[model samples]
Target: MLGKGIIKGMAETARNFLGSYVSAERLTTVQYPEQRIPQIEKARQFPFLVFDGDDPMKGLRCVACQICEKECPPKCIYIVKSKDKRVDYKGQMQLYPATFDIDLSVCMSCQICVEVCPFESIKMDTAYELSTTDRFGGLMVNKHQLAKSNEHYRHIHPTDAAASDAALAVEVAKAQAKAKADIEAKAKAAAEAKAKAAVITPVAPKPVAAT
Candidate 1:
């Protein structure tokens, strides 16, 4: 059994090597700089922020919560909470990040940021062609650079993005419904208060004319 594992591994490698000649699908190795494999759907390489609408800043899903920055293993992510808040796509006001940056050089591509993000603001991207001469400056990505549209997320991870969209839709509906209910309750209360005042005051004018 000492050499059995090694032999099995060699056999598998040999089989794959021989199989590549006959089957195009079996050719797993791609010659870099020239030949490239089609990007797989679930292929994740780095973390990115997801935004909903066309404007990255306004549509940013992150509320500057800093949960991901705190949870990040390498501390590559940095966020600065804004002083002011703006209404989000879901009709909820949220604090946008004044400064959001990520040092890709330090990031290990662990995807922990994606896992811990509750706001669906962060997700993994499949882009791997990140070569740059200016390593330091180029690798330091800001919020504007890190922000990607929801459409890109959907294109990369259709299933998860679809689920996220569905959840957001449900939340938006619930918020709208709750707002409507609150308005109705306030209006009903005002009407009832007016009626009570009218009843309490009583008509004093009936006996005043000829008494």
Candidate 2:
């Protein structure tokens, strides 16, 4: 019984070796690139900006709030708010980033930027193949390059993208409703003022005639 355990282990190993050629379940080797293992849904490697529509620059969800830039652990993100104002997709006047950059060489791929972002404009990208030959700026990504469509975000992270989209829709609806209420209140106030003016008689002319 002393050598029984060793015999069993050796027999198992031999069986596996022989079964690898004939049994589909026994084959474990993978040919990468051409036949890669499926990536997990939660797997993330880098950060990318999410845009709403076809134009990346005009449709970017970021208002250049600089929260992500300040919260970045590695200090890889850089941004500058635009001086010119523009109306966003939500019909609110907002400042876009004139310049945004992320140095991939220095990035730690921490999801803190994505978490601290208030606008839901930042997301972790699944791309990991970022090899480069240039030393100065090949890995330095700018706003134009970092911007990706919301459709792309849904493709990579369907659940998260759906939740964010729903939240944004709710916010937009709230803002629109507030704007409509304000307009109605102003119109009602103006109508009341006009009615009070019309109700007032020509008492001033009667007083002048008595003088």
Candidate 3:
């Protein structure tokens, strides 16, 4: 019976060997590279940031919170902040970042930067075609090099880009509404305080009771 089992297994192997060469009738391996393979939706690849198309620089959604920098397993991101020099709505000068850099050589592409960004400023790119002659200088990408338009982002990851845009819009609307409500509440409280202060109390004459 043991010998019969071995013979049966060998017979199956022989059949498969013959089946592989059956050309049109065979279920066989696919040719790679020349014949492309479809990628799954959730596949993780090289990381890059998504930008808003309208205003390229301002669209950097990153508020320079530095949470990504601190959380990075590798210290790949380098950021330098300078005075914004732009006048705010209150006519006051604001301080903002002047320079932001990321060294791709050190980057592990862990997607942590993309994950932790509260502003949805950054996301992992699907592009895996990075090859260069020089490893040290050529690999490290600066802000200018790293920047990509929102249109470009949509082209690469349309579904994710759309979702991020929607989320950002909602956040902005909520912030604006909350700010407006706060301003109105403050104004109402001030008016009520003023009205209460303006109330005049009648002075009772001491001789009124005697009269």
Query: Taking the tens digit of each residue's C-alpha lDDT, what string does model 3 give over 44-103?
Result: 565555555465565555556677888889988877766555432222344334677888
TM agreement with the true structure for every prediction: 0.81, 0.82, 0.70
* Candidate 2 C-alpha lDDT tens digits along 30-108: 8777888878988899999999878999999999999999999889999999999899878989999999999999999
RMSD (CA, Å), each prediction:
4.7, 3.7, 7.1
The models' CA-based lDDT, in order, is 0.89, 0.90, 0.70
Off by over 4 Å in 2: 1-29, 199-211
TM-score-best of 1 and 2: 2
Which ten-residue region of model 3 has the weakest summed lDDT?
Answer: 87-96
- Regions of candidate 3 where Cα sits further than 4 Å from its true position: 1-35, 85-96, 200-211
Inter-residue clash pairs, candidate 1: none
User: 1 or 2: which has the higher lDDT?
Assistant: 2
TM-score winner between 1 and 3, please give it.
1
